[model samples]
Target: MESTQTVPINQKKTDKYPKSVPYIIGNEAAERFSFYGMRSILPTFLVAQFFNPSSNPAMQTMAEAQANEQTHFFVALAYAMPLVGGILADWFFGKYKVILYISLLYCIGHLTLAIYDHDLQGFTFGLVLIAIGAGCIKSCVSANVGDQFDESNQHLMSKVYGWFYFSINAGSVFATLMIPIIYAKYGSAWAFGVPGILMALATFIFWLGRRKYRKVPPSGIQRNNFLFISLYALANVGKKKKGESWLDVAKANFKEESVEGVKAVYRVLMVFAFIPIFWAMWDQNLSEWVLQAAKMDRTVFGIELLPEQVQTVNPMFLLSLIPVFTYIIYPFFDKLGLKTTPLRRIGTGLFLTACSFVIIALIQEQIDNGGSPTIWWQILAYFLLSAAEVLVSITGLEYAYTHSPKAMKSTMSAIWLLTVAVGNIFVSLVNSSIANKGFFAQLEGATYFWFFVGLMMAFLLVFMLVSGRIKERSFIVNEAEA
Candidate 1:
């Protein structure tokens, strides 16, 4: 007897991306401008503008340290909230609706900053809201970009992700450059208010694409989610009665289709385990690096630069490098028979990040010795860091999108974002530990930057080893449309 089974139909191949991609890109540009603009000045704002000089001397004495700590805490919370946001999108509201609702909250958060720039109470509330709003949308927005294509147009995924990152840098470059000028010249209200306006525009642009988007609805209640499969695997770990592996025993609890999905999620999670350490180094470009800039002379060609404005270098370098790598450098390497695998690119990125910190450590040494290093040294550091970002951060997005099962793409994106959260948390903990312990007082200077370099180097070796051990697998197989 012969048995019949249903085969999944493949989407038709298309050379062009969806028309709605522009709307999403526009939304991202504006939203990133809003986010990075507000954040660009936050460390300075908390230390300078937010607190009144009339406050206690103790508060004034601790201002800089408090500002750094608060900045990381805020960023950590923002990244952490993606976990909840991802769950809500996957289990209930779907990506589009969740993004829409959260964007509104995001707008409100920015407005609160504009309205309450001087009031610590209102400012703190605004940051909290922004954290919630931004964190939630972070997962959905990236996954939404992936939802627009199937196997047919999937070849464009890497290019699209590159452009997506380009849009991010475009906005960030504008914000990091302009917002500081607005804050310095017009005061905090106009600076924060400008971002609010941009955020509102971002929300509207996202909404404009509603009809054109390919909506992936929630998975609804299912027995094969990661949580269930994980629990099942743990419960049956030693209870395998036959020759079945523990994973096979877990698979017995789900339909055939679900087994593959669970395996993909598990594999991706394994990759994610070591990623936070990379982010721990990357996110400092906004926090500690900016603080370092505050102590340096920030003038070039007779135009004085704000400490935060130094960050504009990152986006500027990214804007230039993304294309160079995509069109030239990567292809050259490929033609030379050195195909840059995702894991390899990520590992290379990790090493570059460590190198950037080494530069920072050297610069810090100059500063500690009472020598003023040129801001150009920091520019060089940003150059290396931006290249690292192009390799690691963008590739991670592409990897998450490509590897995730259709039902769990947003969840996987959330997991990727969670790495950033964990990294920020690590920064916060390190800051606190340094503050409390005199034994590690050396952490306050060049030694601290060197420590991260060594730490990242260690992780790079571990990442490469693990990447070699894991077999590459694709959960979805494309078939020509009938």
Candidate 2:
């Protein structure tokens, strides 16, 4: 109960960060540099460098469309694989071991790309490995951050996550800028090899922290696994003698802790239901947005810019805004008697995301109208999008970590990542539809951008309404302590 009490803004003392923080942060920065460095150049590489020159004009058009679709498919698959990784972490190898093993696989993936940059079959095989490796570690790394602290230092969780996100952007900022240049000037081998080298370094950095980390052992087999409980709940539906719901009956069969865990998960899932929509909008920065940039005059301040290089704007803003939000904006609101709760921040993020697409649509409209809008317009969109990312993505990490059951933290983290998977799948479908001249044929270009804006706006309204109804659960007590 004491843990549930809200500490006043000024009274909340900043906890000394864990010694392990630097190692984790260093590993994350390098890993993000590796991943985003490779990813930032993917769309252009697939569309331009991987084409079959012997194909007919119509086949060439189809091949380009296929390349775009395949890029989204790869992203979607990468995010989707976290489910497998999460299960492995929570139920088998635990977070640290799983991350270490998959990281090696990740390195191999990048190596394959460097070795076979010109071969489509080999390049794709490499992508598959990278996707699996990246997805596996995605949930564990964030959850591992939370594992580093307990009640004594819990207050600093938000700040640590801020730094965590800052490190991500820090890595991305450099990778997004430099990798594109490497890809354009020195070609794919150097681009891919550089990231692979970074990944190898990232793996080594993570190993350096092994002895220092506060590792949570796997829960092993449990009857209280979410899947088993859910099945039992369904099996026993309406079996209770009273007028109580099926869930209540199911709760009666579990220990008090297990019941509480299920309830917490339910609450988190309710919040997660709307998150995929936000992700759907957020992920476009890597794909559609880059495609749009390729058409614009990318010379800014006497420097020619690769289309992919524009992605640096996102991480640059993240670097600036995260500190502002952490030290200033959020704390200011806290002092003013306006608590910036995670859900509230997420809601604000959704609105900002919708607004970003509105900016994107306007920019697209100008492009459609044959007006060469300055690259600054796209920068404005990146600002809005990055702000939304800080609000939603960073806050969501905190929320998932704090709200999950002790044993299920990795599992919940995986669930959170699955929302990104869902979003990417949604984008893939949209891209497919537009490419195939199907249902979305009439909504190409600016209209496509406007359509997403409307969708996000609708999601924002629903998310706000739902958030108002769902009461937040108390933070989980550490199982070891309990």
Candidate 3:
């Protein structure tokens, strides 16, 4: 049995890091730059850049749309597969081992894409491998941060998560700026190759932090956390009393440390149900959104911007806006006693997503009316969407970590990320159905996108209402400062 000391059996000693954090931040920045760089190029490459529309009459009608859908489907699959990877790491291989092996696979996946170049079969295989590898690393890296702290240094948890997210955005911003340039100049081979090299560097950095990392032994609890939680939730079904939320009953079953932890996990998971809808919309940037930009005149302020390059705008905004939101908006709200909890932030994010779609819908209306929509409209939408991402994605990460049992942290992180996978599936299914509908024929591109925008807005409203009822979990960060 665990004791009240709150220390795990195999916990390692770590310093309250002011400096070790920079290496993690730098590593994440480079890794994300590589991942996003390749991601930014995929849709355009698959669509007009690679596919031969003239040869396949059926494909010619909506080749770009289909290609975009495929991009989402594959990315979604990549995101989804990590659940398996996370499980394997937790139960068998251990996180460090999983991260190393999968990262190597990830590098290989990138290499396949670069080398296979013209071979469709080889390219698809490479993407799948890379996705799996990325999924594996994604599942563990954040949890690794948590491992670096213990009860004494737990105060630094917030700073660690902050830097973690900062690195992600930093990498994304660089990737956004550079990948498009690489694609436009050196083409796919070098663009994909660059990220491959960076993945290798990320692996090395993971080892560099090895001595400082907390090496908690596996729980040896044969029970699956999800199954256990599900049983507990089911037992209370239809047995409600006055003013008691399901979350309240769920929290009662957890041990003391996990009381707040369990509640946070449940709340995040519940909120997560609503997230896939937003992800469906957010992910369209590489797929449908970029395709839409293709039809627009790409000269912004007399500067030639590739349609793929425009995708970078969101990340750039994310990099700039995170600091603004963290320093300015979040504090401003906190000072006003508005209680900026994770649940509230996630709900607000859904609303912001709705507003983003509404803006996009307006832009589509302009195009339908024979008006040329300015690149500025898209930029405006990206700013709002990026803000929503900061609120949802970053908050969700911290929320997941705070809520999870120490032994199950990485698995829980994977569970939260799994929502993106669900959302991606929805994106692909919707796109495929719309394209297969055969309406508007030549105008299918415009028709399909507007359909998703409207649908996403409707879903967003539903999510906001559903999210409102989820009770906030009582919680505090437990890891130590160093």
Candidate 4:
């Protein structure tokens, strides 16, 4: 049965991508700009507005730490709720319809934040709505893009994924620079309102391409199973013992033996397992790491910059690095017979992330000795982290779509995001530990650094051991053709 359907389903149709892809990409770019713009200043705003930290120096410290914990919890829920949205998109509303519905809710979230800036209960409510709405929209939009192409134009998948990530960073870069400046000048009301406007624009742009999109109808088939295969793979802590491949277990349970899609599904899930640690660190941008930067000097050429403004460095570095990595680095490596596969890049990213933490630890020790660390150290750290992000975050996005079954592509994308949710849960644990306990009592202002460093070391060791045993399944359809 699988063999009969495989050729027809995967057969090449049209070689040209619908010209409307650029409109969708434009919409995503503006939407991301708005989201990151508001988010970039959230930690700083929480301390100053809700906590009233300025009156007391210690309160400032306490507020910053509390904000970190809240940020992690909020981001975790925001990323996690996408699975619920994905279920709805798969089983009920189709992807494009789901995106349209949720985008309005996202706009509402931004409005609430702008209007009720000082009301704690109101703000919390708004954040919850935004998280749910954003999660819903986030999962569906990317999957909607995949639905636009058939086997003939599927060769462009890599380019589409590349442009998708490029747009994200482009939006984020604009927001990072402009939002900080806006937050400093106009305060939270206008800063928050900006994203609402951009989100509205994004909605309009998505609609513009509605006619050109290849609408993949929702498959109503419901298959219930108890296990999450990614977690199951992670449960095997050590090397793959003889005849002990996780794929074997997956194959045994997957009754549809002829459908190679099931085999591909399990393989992707196992690779997905490697990314939890990377996300755990990636989220620190707005949480603990942002707090760390706040304590550092941010002056540039005699002009003092806001701490949040420094966050721009990552996106700026990313804008430059993406071209280098894609055009120069990838081509050079391909020529040398070097394996720069997505999974390998992700592993390398995890190690680079560990190195970022090491730099943080060293800088903290300097601050402990009554030495003011240069702003360049933070800039340097962002560069390293950005490089790591190029590998893990972008690769994860592409990997999620390629490996997902056609029937539940958006759902699987949400599951890939679930890894980020799990990572955020771990981050919350680390942040809460640092804030509430005396575990690193000797580190003083350096407690945050020490805590993260410990986590990174453990992640590096675990990633090294597991990445090797993981099997590769080709999903980039062009690899064979090229």
Candidate 5:
């Protein structure tokens, strides 16, 4: 049990951070290294398993397309499971416990990948385990980071989450740079095995901080969570109290605060609805972008870069840009009489994403014309994409935490992650659709890139118009900072 000295974040009395903060940061770095290390090589490994790259040109094309589809499918499934993870942590096991326990399962998943390096069935089974294990802890980790402080240190929450994201990219940078080299030199088993070791180390680092942690115990097996109470309100609809709201019907069976919280979540979900379009463009970095790199001239300054190595710059850019945005760009914009509000920042990011895809589409056009574009073109695209990600992903995470009901932050974080799944599902569907013979099935290369560019621009226009309708409210966390 955590010390009785631990209190809910909303009730904290000090501006200083709790001891658990560094441990969370450390664990995140190691865990990201492990996750990305494995993921960075997943596409290459899948393609090798399914078909030889040295095969017929048409066969290679089909193989690459299928590999991209399966990769996104795995990504979608991994992200989708966070809802279940959120429910578990919010209603059964506490965040700390759930994270620790599932982390062990995550290690097992990595080990399975290493052991069954050449077996498709076993490798897929490992992906399922890893997806669930990774997905389950994702909500708990993000929410648990917030739960460490109350209003006393709420202002620091933003800085901490910044660091949280930094650690993620830090690890990703290391893995993306190193793992591909490992895969090239040592082959599949060692490439996957190395990440498994990092995961175990991540687990140990988390466990070491257990005693000093400010743990939030779960709301144990009660019929009082968001789902149950929302259903209760629906059943009791039209039986409302005279002066109360529609949701107040559930006040007979539950608390008024709980019902209002759900309403707030619903409103936030409206803003969230348009975000999948942004993600559809952003996550293509791993799928479509990597494949695009393979066809480009990797030589820059006489040093030939590996296709995967080109993406390492993304994390590197993020590392520098996050601080630049926080300390320079945003402050400069604010001084110039422009309010860099979260919604506005997100809108700018969406526009930038569309711009990046324009560059990508142009590159695809070159590739289709049998020209190998310089890797520098793709690098420039990644810069725009990275900047866009800093705004959309980081700002969105902080928004999800601060704007939603305090009671279900884990669930809210899970909801945010589910948007990624939704976006990837769209990509996967499009990927599979191309495999069939249809009008659009003939669409590949630059044509495919233009399709997403148009899609994103349409969504960006919609998001800009609708996001203004979202009524954002600040909670105890970071209230003073605003």
Candidate 6:
């Protein structure tokens, strides 16, 4: 095994992929399977196995809505916890230790769900642990993928990231299809326990690669960390001299580089402010869309499909669409004199996302009009949604990474993930509110979907205006170029 000090920040670039790459990618595939598998059935499990036990239709409807709200809250917490995980890894333990230790807790979360299927208190506790565990490691794991490469293999990093994303979708597609069937055929215990076992396997696979990894050590408590810089800037903003912004005041006590980095993050965050709404609409494919499927004719070509199982369409489309866009669509567009820029992709995605919701709202109107439309309507909606995902999500992460300052690279990843938390929380708030009361009470039935459509279109305008004005800032470059 290499010492903590063995790996340097700059090393010779190699054309060959690192041997550890396989282990890391493999770990991600399995880990994604575990994570998505558990969540795929979670909303249904909550509504059916626990919350909706009462026979009254009113009670059942309330239970269903509450289950959906709880599901979003769970997602919100899971994404929100990345801050804690990032802080611990950066300031105390390295990524490897934090991931492993927290993953053990993650396994316990699944076990709790499997063992206490009907107990709300235990179930809630289990979810909290899982959310924390998932959030804590999400950023670290993604960062670890790049840590394995240097200049020699730098070109291969993009390809590796592509494969990394491929593995994620592959794992999700399989889990989404399988887990619900397991629950319906056998029971919740097997459904939940299967993913738990996979998580254990993922941990073991990660551990097995210990000797081959180029382990990046933690940077002990530093004044340059995002929190420290932000706090210092806020505390001293009033002392700013002429020709200075609020953050510039911190330059008295902090390095100019650190202040610049903090300011860059703030600038990037302005663009990010509109992104949570994307997640708010996109994540509904898991909760609201699934519930919608329950009211549809889920049979196609003589085969019956479970409502929970329908979400497999999104990832399934993702597997095919990502490659299609990279090799065919992108090249074709380039030849036509329109290079596929990240912001362009994001803007296009925002529009398509709103279009997809319009489809969903239309379908809901059909259902409300006492029509049992084919599952293909939702499947069609997933295609547009999945395409939007390939455009927005994949491009957005790369955008976040490239734009961050070197000092705040990992911190930016966590902040990007925090957007998803914000999105889910927004959904939870809207779902838990509106309903039979509140300002948006009129936003019932298909009107709910239409509201999100308006939200997406409004942000699309903001993003186009903002993204056009900002220049790309690459932290992965030389100081002068940066």
Clashing pairs in 5: 9-150
Any runs in candidate 3 off by more than 4 Å, and if so which?
A: 1-26, 53-61, 150-162, 204-221, 228-268, 326-344, 365-372, 398-412, 435-443, 464-468, 477-482
Model 4: per-residue lDDT, tens digit, 306-350? 788788888788888888999998789989999697777887788
For model 4, which pairs clash? none
TM-scores, all candidates, are 0.84, 0.84, 0.80, 0.81, 0.87, 0.90
- Which structure among the candidates has the greatest TM-score? 6
Which ranges in model 2 have alpha carbons more than 4 Å from their true place?
Answer: 1-23, 51-65, 143-166, 207-217, 240-243, 330-341, 401-408, 476-482
Residue 99 lDDT, candidate 4, scale 0-100 = 82
How do the residues 33-81 of candidate 6 rate in per-residue lDDT, one tens digit apiece?
A: 9999999998878878777765465665556667777899999999999
Write candidate 5's Cα lDDT for 322-386 as tens digits: 99999999999999999899889888998999999999999999999999999999999999999
Query: In candidate 1, which residue pairs clash?
Result: none
Query: Candidate 5: which stretches are off by over 4 Å?
Result: 1-23, 143-164, 208-214, 222-224, 236-248, 436-440, 475-482
Which model scores highest in lDDT?
6
Can you write out model 3's per-residue Cα lDDT over 1-482, one digit (the tens) per residue? 56364556676445557444665676677778778888887877876556643547467446665676678888898888778776666677777777777878888888998998778889989988988888877766776677766676677789789879878977877777787788778877888888888887887876686665556555544453655655775787566567965544555565444434445566667767777887888888766677667656678898978777788788778878888988998899999999788878887887787677667777776766767777778878888999999998989877777666564565567777788888888777665664575433334534555666667667667776776687654334345421
Whole-model lDDT per candidate: 0.84, 0.84, 0.73, 0.74, 0.84, 0.86
Q: Can you rank all candidates by lDDT, best first?
A: 6, 5, 2, 1, 4, 3
Provide the lDDT at 418 for model 3: 81
Cα-based lDDT at residue 224, candidate 3: 35
Model 3 has an lDDT value of 0.73
Pitting candidate 3 against candidate 6, the one with the higher TM-score is 6
- By lDDT, the better pick of 2 and 4 is 2
Task: State the lDDT of candidate 1 residue by residue for 66-161, as single tens digits.
Answer: 666677878999999988888888779999999999999999999999999888889989999999999989878887898998767777888887
Judged by lDDT against the true structure, how good is candidate 2?
A: 0.84
Residue 218, candidate 6: Cα error in Å is: 1.8
Model 3: residue 162 alpha-carbon error in angstroms: 4.1
